[model samples]
Target: MIDYGSEIAITGDDPMMDFRADPDLIEFIEKLGRARNHYLSLTRGDFTLLYENEGMAVYTRSYKNETAFIALNNTSEKQEILIPTDKLGSKKQLIGLVNNDLIKEQNGNYPLSINGEESEIYIVRDNHGLKMLNVIVIIAIPIVFLILYFYIWKRGKNNG
Candidate 1:
């Protein structure tokens, strides 16, 4: 079967149609479609190489308002890459778009791990803000209320 269009046509160039396609081909195509969808929405900008060592390369796609970090493990083995503080800007965490993995900043380094021949896109964000907010709400507010109550009680007793 051939698929035709007007300009910049595909011309049925997909060779997999000529032979016995693998049973998993459908699922694989679905996965590829999902990745393509994500790329269209999240990765539309100038790409900058962030880190490269041995068999892995990390990059960030920037478009004024949005930025996405992508790490690729080209080799057939697992890779662990340590991203330094300079490349991280002020972001403290990487939230995965595909695998939903969360990589946190530890001691100024972001630890990245990827499986053999895999890639991941991440959204950078800060983890410290919520922590400080928790401390203020759970710890600081109660302490201030307790001090005020104690002062009023002491003043009332003295007057009585």
Candidate 2:
């Protein structure tokens, strides 16, 4: 067994004295910790390896009817990845979790581009939610009118 206490000073100045009080470094470290926790949580779910190439890896995680896509570019050059929507079980608009950017699907493929040594996390959401809401509203309008019409007719008959 090795003694860990001997490697660090017990009652002296800290070895990293300069960086200990830096606000930006502290904030960056905190953010990095949060990112790491999020990544771990994502990995614990139903994860599927979508693609892996020489310089890139892509995967998807799904939980509770929500799905996310993760892509890592291992090389120093920028890489563009085309993900098939069928692999995700449904075609939807992918939104970047970090930047809130929208990725549209075209020709049954969703394209994602990442920079060197960069990783991107995206949430998959159906873009048709609003359209479905509109359809519900359109269908409800006629039913609401019919109910009002019947109520007024009954009131008129009772009064007359």
Candidate 3:
């Protein structure tokens, strides 16, 4: 958890920004979500973020107004994240999920809002087709089994 008033000097595109957890907010941040990568975008500056493996990079566009942007990626296929509401600044906003399809659901508990919009957004990964298979199993497998059982039982009655 980042403290509400912690003064964090965000500069350049340091990898540390990926999980920019404030020391003062550590206790609070720990309770919310695991710090992955975090960074702030200044409207008038240029920066680059390089991943440890160099496979991922984040480029920023500086504007005259103060705009803060954060990108979170759950390299793992299954992950759960918590966002601490108290640590977020008033001006902090989520630019990506505002009106897009990535948003799965929203809750009122967390201050997970962007650009003055207060709402929680749930993000679901495609899971490389495995997730789809899982869903099919849950719904289709049972129906298929029941149909096969009925078909075999009816055929035996007719034969007898």
Candidate 4:
């Protein structure tokens, strides 16, 4: 966790790391969390307002076409924050938590939101093998029935 009132440097290839704490950053984080509905359990205690000269680093992650918010306090004090996880667009990774918690390289809980507003989102990963199995089963049923139908029809015709 970053101190509530300190300068934090985010070095990465992420385009959102603008290194500015203006109202826009705060609004962007809030809006992203709301739109994505990633955190449905977020509450008022989750966020704390930064006074002038106080700022924090808001980290975001994208995975499996979902977004996650990780609010880090760079200030000198621990602040309650209400970070919006929905506005992250198609990213996945929870804020304030490491990536090893939720899914592989995923962190934090679901239904996280800003200021107690539920971000109606739930995260889940799909196994391709299961999907393929279901498809094969569904297709095989009809194919087998067709083959049996032809075999019986030919046998009856020859016997007659």
Name the top TM-score candidate. 2
Greater TM-score among 2 and 3 belongs to: 2
Question: What lDDT score is found at residue 58 in candidate 3?
Answer: 24
What are the per-model numbers of colliding residue pairs? 0, 0, 12, 39
Residues 30-142, model 4: lDDT tens digits: 55556445444332123323222245444444454443445444455554443333443223433333222332222322333222212222232332234778889999999
Candidate 1 structure, TM-score to reference: 0.58
Which pairs clash inside model 2? none
Question: Rank order by lDDT, top first?
Answer: 1, 2, 4, 3
Which candidate should be chosen as best, given lDDT against the real structure? 1
Worst 10-residue lDDT window for candidate 4 reads 113-122
Cα distance off (Å), candidate 2, residue 145: 30
Scanning candidate 1 in windows of ten residues, the lowest lDDT window is 1-10
Model 3 lDDT-worst window of ten: 50-59
Full-model lDDT for every candidate: 0.74, 0.73, 0.38, 0.43
Question: What is candidate 1's local distance difference test score?
Answer: 0.74
Q: Against the true structure, candidate 4 has what lDDT?
A: 0.43
Q: Which tens-of-lDDT digit does each residue in 26-67 have in candidate 3? A: 543442342222222332454433122212222333334433
Candidate 2 TM-score, C-alpha based: 0.58
Expressed as tens digits, the lDDT of each residue in 4-54 for candidate 1 is 331223347775444434545454445545655665535467778988888
